[model samples]
Target: MIVAGFGWRTGANLGAIRSALASAQQGQPPVTALAAPHDKLALVSPLAEALGVAMIAVSPSALQSSPTPTQSPASLKARATGSVAEAAALAAAGPGAWLLTTRHISPDRTATCALARSCTEGPAQ
Candidate 1:
């Protein structure tokens, strides 16, 4: 399964979220789900619906253990993750998942996206 994860600032609109995901998805497999912090489900729900993919709410505890390729001071300070987008994707993709891209920022700079692929190939919830 391929998962696309997002991290966004307050007031980020659907356009910004979509732009970031598009940028991150370049050369990647089709995304089966969208993910975001459990506390921030609203951040990714709209995009998930627009993409017609499943939504995965990642827990803070899960983010804590998932290592990311990129570091964002704000993300690290606020969520204990080097990159919220990367961490969310890795966590939601489950065991043995690896990032396909680090993070891609939206044109508006209000959102970011990262992609990760699961080790297993069956359907994902």
Candidate 2:
């Protein structure tokens, strides 16, 4: 499965989320699920519905353990991770999943997106 995870600031709108997802995908595989930190469920739910995909709420502990190559001081301070989008995508994609897109921020910089695919496909290209 391919999962797209998001991280966004308060008051982020659907446009920001959609823009970030588009930037992350770049004509890649379809995203089967949308993921975000549990606290962000309210924000992600609408996006999931719009995308017609399931939403996965990743736990704080899982986000911390998921490795991400990028680092964001703001995200690290808020969620104990450098990249919430990347960590959430990896967690929701389940064990052995790897990142296809690290993190792509929206034009407004109010949201970010990351993509991950199941390990069954081997390492992410």
Candidate 3:
């Protein structure tokens, strides 16, 4: 299904997301996922294996902690974040690929449910 499963640490792009969905519908190839960055391995490895999807790990060591500001910033810097940069690179390489979110929607809807949603293209909620 070309499901690119990832986490909040895993960046997703609209182009890639669309591509993954199209590829899944076409059934021309297995879902292509980008493994979470190396630092995120402890988190994404098991989930990726459980889903049984094809993934290529790139710059796994690039994952680092980022802080989200709750208050308005004095300046609007266009600096891109971690996974977002990865997703952009992927988008450049291949458009319309879906990058799965690493963040869980809920406790019950973890690995399996997320995978199901990718396969079924239905809401996991």
**Best by lDDT, which number?**
2
| Candidate 2: tens digits of C-alpha lDDT, residues 44-86 | 8987998799999999999999989999999999999889999
Better of 1 and 2 by lDDT: 2
Off by over 4 Å in 2: 123-125
For model 2 the local lDDT of residue 39 reads 88
Model 3 regions lying over 4 Å from their true place: 1-5, 9-30, 60-79, 82-125
Off by over 4 Å in 1: 122-125
- Pairs of residues clashing in candidate 2: none
Query: If scored against the real structure, what TM-score would every candidate get?
Result: 0.92, 0.94, 0.34
Better of 1 and 2 by TM-score: 2
> Candidate 2 deviates by what RMSD?
1.3
* Highest TM-score against the true fold, candidate: 2
Using lDDT as the measure, what is the rank order of every candidate, best first?
2, 1, 3
lDDT of 2: 0.92
Write one digit per residue (lDDT tens) for candidate 3, span 48-102.
4655654544352222222222111211122233333233223322333333332
Deviation in Å, model 2, residue 79 alpha carbon = 0.3
Taken over the whole model, the C-alpha lDDT of each candidate is 0.89, 0.92, 0.33
| Error in Å for residue 52 of model 2 | 1.7
